[model samples]
Target chain A: GIQVEQSPPDLILQEGANSTLRCNFSDSVNNLQWFHQNPWGQLINLFYIPSGTKQNGRLSATTVATERYSLLYISSSQTTDSGVYFCAVARGSQGNLIFGKGTKLSVKP
Target chain B: DAGVTQSPTHLIKTRGQQVTLRCSPKSGHDTVSWYQQALGQGPQFIFQYYEEEERQRGNFPDRFSGHQFPNYSSELNVNALLLGDSALYLCASSSRQVGYGYTFGSGTRLTVV
Candidate 1:
C-alpha cells in the first residue's frame, strides 16, 4: 500500500494572500491529482499534474515525481477558497487513488 | 455534459441495516470507482468497476460490494452496516482511453444510528 501525507494539516490566510500546500508520497505514483472540497462537499478537480507544473487561474500545482512530492499553490486567495485541499495519487495501473488527509484552508476577508 | 451524478445525497439508517448508493459516471467515461471519506479524513478507495465487472478492489470487507451496468452506471451496497459505517461515499469516473484523472460526484452522506 502507498502512503500519502499532506503538510500544514490546517492553514489560515487573509484575503488576497498566497499559500502553498505540500503532499508527500511513500512510493512512486503513476497518477496524481489536486482537488478542492467545497463546503457543500463537492470534490472539484484542480489539476492532474502527475509531473511537471501547471497553472489555472489563481491555482497552480507542481509535482516532482522523482522526489515523490507535490505542491499546490493558491494565490490572491478569496473567502470562497475556504475548504479542504486534497492531494491523491495512484501508484499502480488500477487507478485507485490514495488520498492525503488534506490541508484545511480558511481564508478570511 | 454532466459530470458524475450520485443519488440520495443524504441517508440515515439503523445498525445492522442494508443500504444501496447509486452513481452515474461522467459522459464518455467508462470506469467507475467508489471511495469512503470519514469525518475529517481523506477518501479511501473501496473498489472500482469496469466493463460491468469488478476490476480492482481495496481493503474493504465482503459486506461492501458493487456492480457496474452497461451504460457505465454503478451501485455500491453495504450490508450489515455498523455505526462506524457512517461516512461520505464518493463516486469518481474516468476514461481508461483518456488515461487521465477522475471527476468526482458530490457524494452521499450516510449516517448509521
Candidate 2:
C-alpha cells in the first residue's frame, strides 16, 4: 500500500485570502484526486489529476506524478470553503484508493 | 445522472448488535468500494466489489463484510458491533476497466453506543 502525507494539518484565513495545500505520496500512482469534504461530510470531487494541472472556479490543482506529489490551490477563498480537503491516489490497477489525513481549512468572513 | 446513493443517512446501535448499510453506485458504474471515515481522520478503505465478487480488502476484520448484487448495488454488514465501529461509511463507484478514480456518496453516519 502507498503512503500518503498531507502538510499543514490545519489552517485558518480571512475570507478572500489564498492558500495552498500539499500532498505527498510514497509511490508512483496511476490515479490521483483531490476532494473537499464539506461540514455535512459529503466528499465533493475537486479534481482527478494524475498529471498536469486543472482548474475549477477559484480552485485549482497540480499533480507531479513523477515526484509523487500534488498541490491544491484555493484563491479568493470563501466561508463555504471551510472544510477538510483530502488527496487520494490509487497505486496499482486495483480499485482501492489511499487517502491522506487531510488539511482542515477554515475561512472566516 | 444520479450519483452514488446511500440509505439510512444515520443510525445508532448498541454494542454487540448487528447492523447493515446499503449503497447504490452511480449510473453506468460497475464497481463499488466501501470506506470508513472516523471523526477527525481520513477515510480508510474497507473493501471493493466487482461483478458481485470481493476483489480487494483492507485491514478490517471478518466482522466487517459486504455483498454486491447483480445490479451493482451493494451492502455492508457489521456483526457484534463495537463502539469503535462508529464512523461515517462512504460508498464509491468507478469504471474499473477504465482505470479511473471514484465518485463517492455522502456517506452513512453510524453511531455505536
Candidate 3:
C-alpha cells in the first residue's frame, strides 16, 4: 500500500490571505487530485495534476511527480474556502486512490 | 451536466442487516468508484467498477460488495452491517480517456446501530 502525508495538519488565516498545502506520497503515481470537502461534506474537485501544474480560479496546484510531492496554493483566500483540503494519488496496478488525512483550512472573514 | 448522483442521502441500519447505496455516474463517465469516510478522515477506497466489472478493490472485507449497471449506475451492498460500517459512503465517477480525474457525489451518510 502507498502512503500519502499532508503537511501542517491544520491552518488558519484571515480572508484575502495566501497559503500553501502540501502532499507527499510514498511511491510513483499515475494520477493525483486535490479536493475541497466543504462544510456540507461534498468533495469538490480542485485539480487533477498528476505530473504538472494547473490552476482553477483562485486555487492552483503543482505536482512534482518524480519527487512524489504536490502543493496546492490558495491565493486571496475567502471564507468560502474554509474546509478540509485533500490530496489523493492513484498508483499500483489496481489504480485505487490513496488519500492523505488532509489539511484543515479555516479562513475567517 | 448532473455530476455523480447518490441516492438516499442518509440511511440507518441495524447490526446484522443489509443495506444498499446507489450511485449514478456523471454524464459520459464510464467508471465508478466507492469510498468510505469516517468522521474527520479522508475518503478510503472501497472498490472500483468499470464496464460493469470489478476492476479493483481496497482492503475492505467481503461484507462490502457492489454492482455496476450497463448504464454506468452503481450500487454498493453491505451485508451483516456492523457499527464500524457507519460512515459517509462516496461515489466518484471518472473515465480513463479523461485520465483519473474524478467528480464525486455528495455521498450517502450511513449510520449503523
Candidate 4:
C-alpha cells in the first residue's frame, strides 16, 4: 500500500496571506486529488491534479509525479478557506485512494 | 446533477447493536465507495462497490459489510458495533473510466454509546 504524508499538520495565517501545503507519497500513483473538508464534514473537491499544475480561483496545485510529491498553493486566503485539506492518491487506476492525515488551515480575518 | 446524497445525516446507536447507512451516487456515476473518518483524522477507505458487487476493500473487520444495488446505490451495514465505531462515514462516487475523480457526499455522523 502507498503512504501519503502531508506537511504542517496545522497552519494559521491572516486573511490576505499566502501559504503552501505539501504532500509526499511513498510510491508512484496514477490518481491524486485534493479536498477541503468543511466544518460540517462535507469533503469538497479542490483539484484533481494527478500530475502537472492546475489553478482554480485563488487556489492552485502542482504534482510532480516523478518525484512522488504534490504542492497546494493558496493566495490571498479568505476566512472561509479555514478547514482541513486532504491529499489522497491511488496506486493504480482502479486502486483505492489512501489519504493523508491532512493539513488543518485557519485563516483569520 | 446531484453529486452524492447520504441518508440520516446523523445517527446514534448503542454498543452491540447494528446500524445501516445508505448512499446514492451522483448521476452518470456507477461506482460507489465508503470511507470512515475519526475526529482529526483523514478519511480511510472501507470498501468500494461496482456493478452491484464488492470490488475492493480496506483493512476493516467483518463487522463492516456493504452492498451495491442495480441502480448504483449502496448501503453500509455494521454489526456488533463498538464504542470505537463513532465516526463520520463518507460516501464517494466515481465513474469506471480511468483517471476520473470522485464526488463525496456530506457524510453520515454515527455515534455509538
Per-residue lDDT of candidate 4, residues B43-70 (tens digit): 9999999999899999999999999999
**What tens digits encode model 1's per-residue C-alpha lDDT throughout A12-77?**
999999999999999999999999999989999999988999999999999999999999999999
| Regions of candidate 1 where Cα sits further than 4 Å from its true position | none
- What's the true lDDT of residue A1 in model 4? 74
> What are the per-residue Cα lDDT tens digits for candidate 2 across A20-41?
9999999998889899999999
Model 3 CA deviation exceeding 4 Å by range = A92-94
Model 1, position A73: C-alpha lDDT score = 91
Error of 4 at B43 (Å): 0.7
Give per-residue CA lDDT, model 3, range B1-113, as digits (tens).
78999998999999999999999999999999999999999999999999999999888999999999999999999999999999999999988776658889999999999
Ordered from best to worst lDDT, the candidate numbers read 1, 4, 2, 3
Model 4 is docked with a DockQ of 0.81
Model 2, position A109, has a per-residue lDDT of 99
List the lowest-lDDT window of 10 residues for candidate 1 chain B.
Answer: B94-103
Q: List the residue pairs that clash in candidate 3.
A: none
Estimate, for each residue in A1-109, the C-alpha lDDT of model 3 and write its tens digit: 8899999899999999999999999999988989999998999988888888988888899999989999999999999999999999987433788899999999999
Q: Is the docking of candidate 3 incorrect, acceptable, medium or high quality?
A: medium
Off by over 4 Å in 2: none
